[model samples]
Target: MSVLSAAKKVFYLPIMIGEWDMATIVETVAAMRVLVAEARQAGKSIGFVPTMGALHAGHLALMQQAKKNCDIVVVSIFVNPTQFGPNEDFTAYPRTWAEDLAVCRSAGVDAVFHPPARELYPDGWGTWVEVTGVTDKLCGRSRPTHFRGVATVVTKLFNIVQPDQAFFGQKDAQQVIVLRKMVRDLNMVPEIVMVPIVRDEDGLAKSSRNAYLSSEQRQAALVLSQGLAKAREMAAAGEQEPAAIREAVLSHIQSAPQANVDYVELYSFPDLAEIAVLNQDVLLAVAVRFGATRLIDNIILTPSRT
Candidate 1:
């Protein structure tokens, strides 16, 4: 083979020849884009999962979903500074780089776009992306600027990686809602897909923040899932009032001595508008503080048959 042919072979071998053991890790936007361009040139469909990098089974699930749908899967592991509030755990957020890569490799992820915060933001960066209306409830009421940072960074990732479809867990239900709206409003090219939330055998939704929980807090954290499950039971038993469902969840969670409720809200899905009744699919979301650790979980409530 000629030299050019050999170079091309080396570049495309991972996807073209089905080498599946490792994921190519690129730390800068330029390097990541070069990989994306190579994949596009190879006539491959790309799937992306943007993550904060504490690789749980939840992250693995996203990768598996992507691999099933796209020829090339890229995962970004940036702990975005813009998304964290002043009192938030941004500095203390887990960054298990080697473990994260191993998990991705084990799941057959093709590329990992692990860019530093500086590369994405740069000096004197002033732009931000905000989705109105849907941004005022649930986790939004407390986190304030959280969704704006989420929107901005995710928009940047979508542009940089340019995948055919991007996957997100419904654990961050509102974030998914905000991003889907941004895609529709801005005419973004990639399809936004929401994967069902992944939970533990004990029912606590898997999260990077779970690492902060002490043994007691970890056990106490089960209250979040337990409360959500009770809400499902209520809905299944013909309880359709949003206030009643929210109250049921609140009372159940408050019974746990260590569980401090942030908010237990039921909102109309996708648009996130307040609803007096569950006329359609609605999101039942909860956020709680256990010691210094904060965890959020949600379930999508189906419409009442009664």
Candidate 2:
């Protein structure tokens, strides 16, 4: 077997292997392709965890989960420009390649796929992948082309990495739903796993963007999770009306001094269509601004007759 294949088998053994940084080897598509081919030949079923760099505990959690399920884990750190609008924070988005590599290395990630923009999108690239209906709600309504960019970049990553399974955080509930739908509709063969939202001790959902928040804004940001928790509590206490559950969440966030709601929505899970009642599985999602940072959080409410 080739050296690359042997490395994958050793790195991805069922035992918890120490994190290894493969970002240094990910300078080009040609190199990644060869590495992937070798890993596949070694009987390593690939698992992918894609991120926009600035890795955090939440991202690490997802990577660790992927490591458990697949023989090889590939993590991609590219902040796709196509997903960020002109007025958005793309220019200001965090990039800590060195630190991010450390986090991935600690998570036992076998490979870190860090592709540059020009290489992924080439000059004069015009093709875009858009998902209808779902992108028109919550964060999508405010950020417009956001989900399209996510779908496109994710599709491209899936094609390039060709993993047997992929992992995403539940923090971006809408994103998780959109990707799952895209994979199904397009007949992509990877198993999409939606891991639970990872949060701070104070309940703030961990995100790379959270780095942008000032000390005060950081405290104010907890409202998003507070809203989600309120919704969960109300639902468990016998609230079944979607509007009531949504309002319970919204009111908490709106009460915060720094919170400005972009959108606070309740939608059906996986499908993400609007639901008038909370009698089925649903996601209570919100996107709000604290200072200049836009953060999102959600809670999944399974239906109950109580």
Candidate 3:
């Protein structure tokens, strides 16, 4: 073969190759676009899951759902700073890159867009995307700027990856509600998919911040899930009063000596508006603080039928 033919065989030929065994990790938006564009040109449907770097079973579960739904899955891991409050653990957020990639590989993620903070928010960056009403409840009340940061980064990720569908875990039910509303209101193209929360054997929802908890704190953290469970039971047992449901959840979390209850709210699903009764589908959410680590859990309640 001629030198030109050999170069073509080695370089250009590889570009047209059909598959990626694991995920291709790219650190810049430009690189992600090029990779995704090639996949789009090949007529493959893309699915995306945006995350922070500390990979857990929940993150893998999202990717698994993406794999089942779309032809390609892109997982972006950026520890977005805007989402964290001034006192929150932005610096302390875990960044286990090596283990994260391994999990992506096992879960069949197509590409991993792990951009640096500087690249995502360049010098003199000022724009943000915010969703109102829904933002006023749950985790939003305490972390005022949290959803704004989440909205902005997710919008940027959707614009960059432009997936056919994007996946998020139901563990952050408020986040799911906010993003769905944002996509619908803005008329975004990609479908927002909500996967079920993955919990530990002990029933605590999986989270990166769970790593921050000491043994006692971890034990205390179970109350968040347990409280939501009790609220679920109340709704299932023909209880429709919002006040009663909230009280039941509060009582469960209060039983934990180390647990500090933040909020136990029952609100309308998509709109997140207040409800006097639970006649319709509602979200039961709880946030509790154990030492310095804060955790949140939720369950969606559908009215019981005779």
Show model 2 residue runs off by greater than 4 Å: 2-24
Residue 66 miss distance in model 1 (angstroms):
0.4
Q: Model 3, which residues run further than 4 Å from truth?
A: 1-23
* Whole-model lDDT, model 1: 0.85
lDDT of each: 0.85, 0.82, 0.84
Off by over 4 Å in 1: 1-23
In model 1, state the lDDT of residue 46. Answer: 91
* lDDT by residue for model 3 (56-138), tens: 99999999999999987888889999999898899888989778877887897767777778988999999999999789878
lDDT of 1 by residue, 127-219 (tens): 999989888888788989999999999999998999899999999888888888999999999888899989889998999999899999999
Per-residue alpha-carbon lDDT of model 2 for 1-306, expressed as tens digits?
A: 662654344433222224542533364566667778887777889889989989999999999999899887889889889899878888888899778877887887777777778879988888888987678888888889899999999988888889899999999888888887888889999888999988889999899988889999999888888778778888888788998877777888888889988888888886887788888889888889888888888888987676
Q: Is 1 or 2 the stronger prediction by lDDT?
A: 1
Top lDDT: which candidate number?
Answer: 1
Instruction: Rate residue 23 of model 3 by lDDT.
Output: 25
Give each model a TM-score. Answer: 0.92, 0.92, 0.92
